[model samples]
Target: MIPKYRQQFNQDFSQEKYSLLKEYLKQKSGLEPAFRVSESPIFLKKEFESKLIDASESIIDQIKTLSPDLLRKAVPDNCYVPGHTDKPHFLTIDFGICRSENGEIEPQLIELQAFPSLYAFQKVFEDTFCEVYPFLSEIRNKMPHEEFKNYMKDLILGNEDPENVILLEIYPEKQKTAIDFVLTEKLLGIKTVCLTKLKKEGKKLFYENEGKLTEIKRIYNRVIFDELDRILDLKTEFDFREDVDVKWVTHPNWFFKISKFLLPLLQHQFVPKSYFLHEFPENENLENFVLKPLFSFAGSGVNLNPTKEITDVIKDKENYILQRKVNYEPVFEDINGDFSKGEIRLLYIWRENDEPPILLENLARMTKADMVNVDFNKKDAIWIGSSNAFFAE
Candidate 1:
């Protein structure tokens, strides 16, 4: 973190400017985010940025060379989808800023996901932040926002017309992260189609576009298998498991394969020791580890101090992981003099199979609680929530 930039931003910070930012984002994105937006953007030094990039690449290299058997084991039979990409299109790696045993600042691997994140929303967020505070513009991403949008358009849309490419999700409008969906449509000219609304004809899929049955050539899947499985009353015409004509930008199968399940397989200094719940060693103490569901989103079903009693009651031991806890150092100093812990999520997009995913941009979450989720934070916590990271030049 850059102390000078943080101090300057705090000095210029006012209630009116923060309000204007939120209003501007609402007007631009067409929907206000349900989650809290942090008052400040995190500023990272060049050295810290390089360390994050290096650690992420090292972990990804191990995944690239994993045996087929290991990769197949990660996706359960019921959870598997029809098509499989050689590698994930979108990759998000989360690292907790922490202090090492020697009291040196370092990045620790919190988790990694092969699914899409707030890609469209993040670009607008960075722009909105810079608009409110012009001085912060110097630390923006190297690639301009418009160029990045074009890159994403090429990656997601491909050669197909935007009408043929649908951002597929279940009740997307009702989702908490629907702001991303709205912005995705605004940027890519793609429609957000609910899973239940998908119409099937033989091997082909269709969605009603402006009172016309439009053929779906590609699907940008945002449906989580676990969440979809929970909705018992839904009567969907199309199923993800069945063979379909459309291509997946990033296949659903990769979501399970590249989740917390792959944590144990990674051999990196940044990655903490992890093991399947069933494969956990009896000699090791459980208090030092955290229990996490393999595919859950937003820190759901995570136990900070996991005990044997809790691990014993879990029915599907293979679907759980016991990861060693990394102490999240409070590095972001606020105006109140209370330092807040932050988690930096490096978002990457991989268009080619041979080359590793490119680090496009990053989003950070500040928290004074045990976790970064809104449930963990108190009602009145400030300078804590959704934020973007600026690389200090």
Candidate 2:
């Protein structure tokens, strides 16, 4: 972290500025953020930024060479999607800022996902933060607004007409991450379609767009198989496992292959020792690790302290993991001098021809709780929520 910028931003931060920031965001996106937005943006020194990138690269190299059999087996028999891609189009690797045994500030890998994150909203949020805190503009946007928009257009829309490309989700309007969908549509000229609304005509899929049946050519998938499985009463004419005549911007199978299911398999200095619940060593102390449900989202089934009672109730032991806890260094101090632990997520986009994913942007969450989720945060916390990072030039 860049201490100078952090100190300057903290000194200049005011309640009014924070209010203005929230207002600006609402005005831009036409809706208030469902999740809390932190009062500060992280400032990363060049050296720290490099370390983060290097850590990501090391993990990515291993991911690329992962056994094809392992990847194919990661997808559950019932949840397998048809037309799987050879590689993932998007990747989000999260790392907790922690102090190493040698007293160096380093990033410890927390979790990762091959699914999309708040890519559209994150850049705008960074810009909004800079707009409210004018002095912070010195860091500048890593990729200019127009350039980033063009990149997104190519990635999500491809060569298809924007009307033919849809950001497919389940009840997108009711989703917490609807803001990103809204912005994605605004930027790429695509529409968000609910999974249940998709109509099947042989191998092709169609969705109602502006009262007309529009054939879907490409899909920017945002639906999670786990969440979809929970909707027992839901019915959709189209199925993910069907061989649909549409391009998957990110093939859904990658979600499982490159998720927490692969975390235990990753061997890196930044990655914590993770083991499947069924394979956890009997002699190892369970208190030193956190239990995680492989397929859950937004920290739904994360237990900070794992016990035999909790593990016993779980019928699917293979779907759970015991990950060694990484102590998040309280390096980010809030206004009241209380520090917040930060988890930085590096967002990457892998073009079809690119060997490795391109690191486009970074987002961080500040929290004083045991984890970064809103449920764990105290009611009266500040400078602790959804945030972005600015790296030194």
Error of 1 at 323 (Å): 0.6
Compose the digit string of candidate 1's lDDT tens values, residues 187-283: 9999999999999999999999999999999898899888887898989898889998998988998898889999988888889999999999989
Which runs in model 2 stand beyond 4 Å of their true positions? none
Error of 2 at 389 (Å): 0.9
For residue 47, give model 2's deviation from the true position in Å: 1.8
Model 1 alpha-carbon drift over 4 Å, by segment? none
C-alpha displacement of 242 in model 2, angstroms?
A: 1.4
Model 2 TM-score, all chains together: 0.97
> Residues 278-382, candidate 2, lDDT per residue (tens digit)?
999989998999999998888888999888898888898999999999999888877898888888999999879888888777889989887887668889989
Q: All candidates' TM-scores?
A: 0.98, 0.97
